[model samples]
Target: MKKNIFKIFAALFFIAVIVSCRKEDPLNVDFSKLNIDNPVANTPLDTWLTTTFLNEYNIDVIYRYNRFYHGDDRDVAAVKVDKVQPQMQTVLEGFLLPYRKVAGVTFIKKYAPKQFVLFGSGSYNPDNSYTLATAAAGRNITIYDLNSFDLSDPNTIVNKLRTIHHEFTHILNQIVPMPVDFQLITKSTYLATWTTKSDESAQADGYVTPYASSQPGEDFAETTTSLLVYGQAWYDDRANGSTAAGKIALKAKEASVEQYFTVNLGIDFRALQREIQEVVRNTYNYQQASFPYWLGQNLYKSLIVNAAGDPIYSAFPLSTPFSLVNNNMKTAIAALPYGLTYNFMKLNFTSSTAMDIEINFNQGTRSFISRYAYTMDLDQATGQTKFTIAAVGGNDASWVGNANLLRPAVQPMLDYLSNNTFVADWLPTGVDAVNYNKYGGFYVLGTPANNFYGLLGQ
Candidate 1:
């Protein structure tokens, strides 16, 4: 009887132990701290921010704090995250309390897309502890030079947040996906070209960036970044400097961004842009609030596609530069500078091949040649004039006003019968150019001295 009693007690105790051990709690599970930040080791970082941040932004974050490298015993700290779980009773009460009547699983399945990351101390990178989070593909983050973060520099902190959110926006867009046609631009050329080429060059060729020239996926991602993080104004400033080739690529990209945000993402890009500017103004307390973006926008407007969705092209078609001698020469020019108009083309052609010979201040009609400047071009085969004449320079760089000052000022007249046309045939073919603005225009003075800014007038 004693043995039987002892066996029963042991069995009961064993069952109790198993039950206790099997009980799972949401807060205490040990997460990996593999990145440079190593927040897991720095604090008892729980899943507190998980549920909290998501309720506000519909995001989820995953964390991994400590990591190790393979050979030299040095650490490469990068951030990578995967899942988003809700914790904190306070957040739950506020969110769930309102919807207490509905089922819990239903809510989880409906409204939110969880946000999570794996932050680290040692990177899986080649260099220092600099961190980069790609919210688009392979949803991972690698933070470098861990010590570099001041935890100060309000600007830096804000940028970091912005970068993370920017990548997150990309991922969401990718999943939902923009039109595949948007991804088709420059499908053959995307690399790290954005950093390499100047905006002037990009605009000339109809692209937003040299990198954007590489492929469509990159273009799409860049377009999303341009629209969301920097907003239309910043995008405009950056794009205004783009070359003719860049402009074409930019147009495709612009259309994609507009479609994605308005039709797909279900957000107002214009209102969002305003909201973004407001946030920046309020957060940083800057007097101008995106001073660079707004400043660049003025010049950008001249390029075409004003940030407010306006078209500045019809007035300046190369054919009717001043008024067509005919439309054939205008047809072959391909593209022209931004914001130019028939009213602006006040010059007339005096020589052959469509050039201008016009009076300056009503004093003398000087003979000049330009496809755009001299709208009327003498057709070699037909013995008739077709192209029109227009002014190629800005207020400061007009040939009649400051004929001797700037080199690019006379490009319209000079390039017509000169070597400028076939000067660059070595580049990619199938590229027929028309209406491209010169790299720059000349200005004679600012308070009696020469000064200039941007590609076109402000």
Candidate 2:
């Protein structure tokens, strides 16, 4: 009986210890007094952003100041409310539309950053360098200096578009690494203080820009952005202006960049550049109707005709027009009168009222062709165009008599071109609406009372 009582006591003690160690429910406390604000109401800008960016590409844009989106110590401010729409519109037209048209919407949808953060002020560094734009982790882009944006000004618009392209290129590189050969092109020229270098010096060293010399990755991005932003002519001019060795290296880099887009992304870089340029012109409301525009669209030529409306010494066939090919004049030699063969002709515009004209002539079985250069000038006030022989070389003397025979006929056409009142229709045909090679029309010189000479652009 005593043993049984001890067992019951031990069991009771174990139960007590288990109950003490177990968690116990305590008194409930009221926490309703804690203050918490509701979410801010969506603004019109937010609605627009939702429709433009988020709805289209699932990308978010933040124009309002948000501390979380910026670096802790960076000097930046929120984009001005008024500049936001215009800036965003410019970005869409200048940057995004080009990629969409060239690379396809799906490509951008997949590769574009998920978010864009805009700032009114540039993120200025202690070293006097300013950050224009940057991509972060391939997920976000931050564009700076929106407050000073002027879409009406082509230069400012181009510069801002360039920054966007530069950052976008970085994002693209992050997705698919640039070729290792690109990095090796100017590997030794990479510098920590690239800001100190001048653009000419950097270009001479095979770098597209001073910032491009900071690193190989930046170099690739800079090269691509420069090509896209400045267009092909500008890029070619810079490359050709560089030293011979530098030109070769820069061209190699360009080829690599182009190959990266073509082989890897299936994109034609030139077509892309052309598309972007068109968008830029349309977006800026550029005046495409002017004398300069007409001049660029048409190929000008002078024709010599007799009283019976017959050619005396036409450089090209009566029907054939001279056209610009690779920046040089070209025409067909399929039809020639008097056993005359087509050679070459060039027109270099020195200014609004002056041009340097060069023409070459060839005869059957002749060892050499005759070449002559002439200075063509226009008196803007009087609207009179005059041509004076500048330099005569090659076998040109042999053809001087034939040329002189047609001088009387050619003078009238020259007078018509010089006349400011002369009315001529310029019709441009081709992809760009200004490709003189494809369908350059003729200019009707003189009235029916006088012999008509049709001067065609070849």
Candidate 3:
């Protein structure tokens, strides 16, 4: 009986220990304070980002504020939601499409930056200079200054495009290193404190810009971006204005860049340049930078009209107008008793302010010529030129008889030249941008439809 009682006591003790350890505390926590909701609901911008960039090219455009994506210490504002789409559209036109045409869509898919992070405010630096764009590991690009973006403004568009191209060039360099000779061209000119140097000084040292003097990598990027964005005319101006050694170095660097793109990247750099210039001229309306506007020579030795089936023949044909004037002169000459057959006519710009009209005709298998002189009031600033009769026979009194003999036919052509103020242009809208300087002509200032184009000459 004692043994049985001890066993019961031990079992009772085990039960008490188990009950003490399993005691339940009062539940005082409030469930109402807990927060739970879906953070992403497929907003339009989100959907667009996914569809246009991500789905199309495997690119992620992050315009929303995300501290993890930016520098830890820098204060950069997120891109305005409204500004995001327009900015991306510019990117699509100015950057992506150009590359897609020249380098191929496959090239963009393979080499283009995968992520693009945008900010509204400039990335201000301690040096008082703001960062326009940056690339990291050839995978991501960060663009700043979207708050003041103006899509309609050509300057704004070009500035943004320059930054984009500059950053992209860095990514390209990361993939396939720029030619070592590019670095060696201006090896001794690079500066650690490049901010101290002016752009003029940088050009003097063979660097394209002050920032390019920071390092060889930046030099490469700047050079490539400038050529791509500014076109060949600007480069020529820069080279022409640079020091002798700078000009040589700049040319070498330019050649090196062309070689790198052609050999390393398998891209036709000239075709790419032409393609970019076409957009700059046609889309951006940068006509002043075209070839014709910069020609130092004022004389046009020959005028060749665009024939039938040409690009501008249907809309703005000079051939028809020229033929009418020539035929009228022919009929008038045919009525003359000299038995002269009308041959051809020429407009010679002998000087900036002087021109000669040469009337060539055939009399009994022998050619005869008459020259008429005129003065030109050419306002290059306004691209308007006015012609006035200086002398009917020019410097030869003997030719005065022929000038008076053909008065009826010559008077009409003469009146046309002296009466109309023709505006000189490279036919910016009609012909290819590649032929801007090679061929151009003058149209009535207010009446573009009344224009005539020809081979621009020296």
At residue 189, give the lDDT of candidate 3. Answer: 83
The digit string of per-residue lDDT tens for model 1 on 253-358 reads: 7877767767775555554444444444445333223332232223322211111121323332221221222132232222333221121222222333333432
Off by over 4 Å in 2: 1-39, 285-338, 349-354, 367-429, 432-458
Query: Which window of 10 residues has the lowest lDDT sum in candidate 2?
Result: 321-330
| Model 3 ranges off by over 4 Å | 1-41, 287-318, 322-419, 427-439, 444-458
Q: How accurate is candidate 3 locally (lDDT)?
A: 0.77
TM-score for model 3? 0.69
Higher-scoring candidate on TM-score, 1 or 2 = 2
User: By lDDT, is 1 or 2 better?
Assistant: 2
Steric clash pairs (candidate 2)? 321-458, 322-457, 322-458, 323-458, 383-418, 385-418
The 10-residue segment of model 1 with minimum total lDDT is 422-431
Q: Estimate each model's TM-score.
A: 0.43, 0.69, 0.69
Local distance difference test, per candidate? 0.40, 0.62, 0.77
